[model samples]
Target: MDPIRTDVDAPFGRIADLIALNARQSPDRLALADAQDSIGYAALDALMDRVAAGLQRDGVVHGDAIAICAASSVAYAAVFLGALRAGVAVAPLAPGSTPASLARMMRDADARLLFTDAAAAEVIGAPGEDAITRIALDASAAGQALADWLPPPGTRPFPVDVQPASAFNIIYSSGTTGEPKGIVQGHGMRWAHVQRGARYGYGPDTVTLLSTPLYSNTTLVVFFPTLAFGGCVVLMPKFDAAGYLQIAQARGVTHTMLVPVQYQRLMAHPAFDAHDLSRFQYKFSTSAPFNAALKADVLQRWPGGLIEFYGMTEGGGTVILEAHLHPTKLHTVGQPAPGSDIRLIDEEGREVPPGEAGEVVGHSSGMMTGYHRQPAKTREAEWFAPDGKRFIRTGDIGRFDDEGFLTLFDRKKDMIISGGFNIYPSDLETVLRAHPGVADVAVVGAPSVQWGETPEGYVVRRDGHAVDAAELLAWANAQLGKTQRLARLHFIDELPRSAIGKVLKRELRELNPS
Candidate 1:
């Protein structure tokens, strides 16, 4: 497990340069595609040049932030790369965020221009006093159309000086409340990802189907690598189980990145096994917890290597669980990746002994620069070892097994304290998930008059099954320690999730009586 070499003098310093190199070598190859359109390597290279020129003409230069709030599309991809080509940083704001939040993010990034499609524009409405220049990706009343926004076809922007430390993009954290913090990633971090991705079989012949939003780091972790290695990427504006299966089979897709919920939906689809997915060489899952049972099912049924990546968007250490190779370690998140260091500490900031759960913190080369314009928040996220090495606090509670595999228990903030005893929600959630009647479940700390804070369970019943909350609670309590018993249980239609399928525990906590 050698570290990914950082080659400052590589043939292509920037990702845009890599795209240009691919165009020169494989002119006729498909560079990108969506349901409605496709672009060749040569044409995509040319389009990127025009887009860079257009931004330059509008006074966008190095270090400037260009905000894109739209659905995934060929134009959206082009604009993202174009901004990078001009040495500008991109802030991919989520269209699903509220208008006020979006406005705050735009201000935080100091974006002078905004690119959006009709649906996103409708959600955002007018820019008002934000003073952002608007360009529409589709027909909309929001701003100028993309076609009119660009300069002539052959136009090229001036040459840029890109360094390893140059700002690359701003990824906003999915905060449960208030304004989200913008995590600033640099070119060096992205370059490390692109270089290391080759071990997973990304190359010129690779065809990656990305169904996640471009706004998410989960998608870009695979998306940028596919293009950097000269692979074709197929974009899905919105995820549909049937459509995903159809596209994968029809296009002979070779690789893909999907969240756990998407995988659950695909596995439940009636036509799941009906399609031919033998061409898939690798599949990735991240951004949420992947159940061990689901991983085993995928390994047994799906025709590809299933790799689960455990890490934060803030980019400290990463754990890679190759379910195909280490079937016995499926319960753990595997060992830390090469060049990554992970440690656990207790509440008093002391290093916890091995096999004892503690707050997970880590250090790695792929770490983000800092939270944009939030120096105090950035400082709060860091921890230091005796050797003076800096580590990012993951805020997760996990312990290493004798074999060095890491098993996560629960988030530090989600831990329940009942009657002066520490309780891990994941320990309780595991028991609940084993129940036949439970389709999905989330455990959160609820206010309890007797115990201060007690564990509560929110459950989604399996289809065609009737479950009484009291009955289910009694059954679950039978398998748990007395102190860990659920104080209350609530039946819900479904768990509230973020766009990337992360369960929103904050929202569930709100449902509990104070």
Candidate 2:
């Protein structure tokens, strides 16, 4: 039996089809917007057609990759959708990545045309000796500008067929070392996501405020759904707590997907309570461990159904915790989503009994096809069940409660073995976050002579709060088990995070002495 449902005929076969339909049905509705500009559905559709024509004229054909590294804007969205319309896969590279890494990824994707804005072009100076076309989204020294690159108005691209199995986009992982592996997400997978998202209240009247970068899947999950459902999307080039609230209130935003750090910042901002967010019908949090305390605070202060999604970009079984409905289960990541099968496996690859901690693995219709061009790495990411079903290994240590909710401990690689005992850094960080002086905290294993490894903490203090790291460490240790006690504590202004707000634990580990 195929996991994806084939019984019901979907209204649109591809994402581009849905966009085209919306343009014909609601031509004057707002499709995309930013602080500077907004585009209606009709104009967005025409722009995408021209973009497809331009790419076709420039030799970007079916299955070929087109790389875009720029701030989110109307033009960026057009280029992305236009590539899809032309049956080409998009490789949205992170602008925050180093120039060397960016260049390496472009080579790996074999991207024929590279698009960038002025700010990103400045950072990504020049393309390597490899011959590739560079098209700047804005005026810059980076090859030709958008106006010069696009084909003449009314030029139409040749029709190309798009299958469900066709590659839709390549999302690179946030690996700190070496080149990041590209996860190949197919059109069917994206369609599954869009269909599933409609249940969460996305529709023609829905307005989604995207504060994260377009390159991040966390943003695309909401971004594509809003457009596919004929809703409006407001893009934020850079997230600011004050500015987000103002936009949310002014735009009458009905939906949003934000990481935990963004929520924390919004909650901490002085003006957060001043704005009216009652228009929000649904709010999403993912890509990090959201503290239960913070979830409770948001539920109390913010008006919306708070949902937390726990899964990886590589696609596996997803766990959805509706924090608004299940207030008591806020500690867990909620139950497995409908039709999603989740199980825990021991280090030896044997399935663990319920209520026991093990590596989290899952199977679902929405899983990615595989890591791009890396068969060995792709095989390493899979775990086969006895019945011959394949599951994606999440690399997270978690246990299911009697109620079937999953409680995550830490990353499998991040777990510390101290004196032959497993020490989960998340357990220690949870205790540290409870401290009044501790605004944020991250725990990582530090090499030790006494034991193979021990826990060390990096903490950020609350505003206007003065407390010694030694005193806070002592207080936290008093509440923790002997093996979980921190060996050292350091105070920093803020914890380093990725573009989507996941803590960079590898960077913290590098600070520890070997």
Show the lowest summed lDDT stretch of 10 residues, model 2: 1-10
List the pairs of residues colliding in candidate 2. none
| Model 2 per-residue lDDT at 443 | 92
Off by over 4 Å in 2: 1-12, 176-178
User: Model 1 off-target regions past 4 Å?
Assistant: 1-12
Question: What is candidate 1's local distance difference test score?
Answer: 0.89
- Cα lDDT of model 2 by residue, 1-514, tens digit: 2111232137337888788888888899999999888999988888888999888887889999999999999888999999999999999999988888888888888898999987888777766677587888866777688988888777778888998789999999987434699999988778877887867888788999999999999999889988988899999999999999999999999999999999999999998899999999999989999999999999999998999999888888799999999999989999999878999999999999867899999998788889989999999999999999999999999999989899999999989999999999999999999888889999989988899999999999998889898899889999999878899998888898999999998898877667
CA lDDT of every candidate? 0.89, 0.89
Local accuracy of candidate 1 as per-residue lDDT tens digits, 136-159: 887577689888888988898899
Model 1 pairs whose backbones collide: none
Compute the lDDT of residue 377 as modeled in candidate 1: 91
Name the weakest run of 10 consecutive residues (lDDT summed) in model 1: 1-10
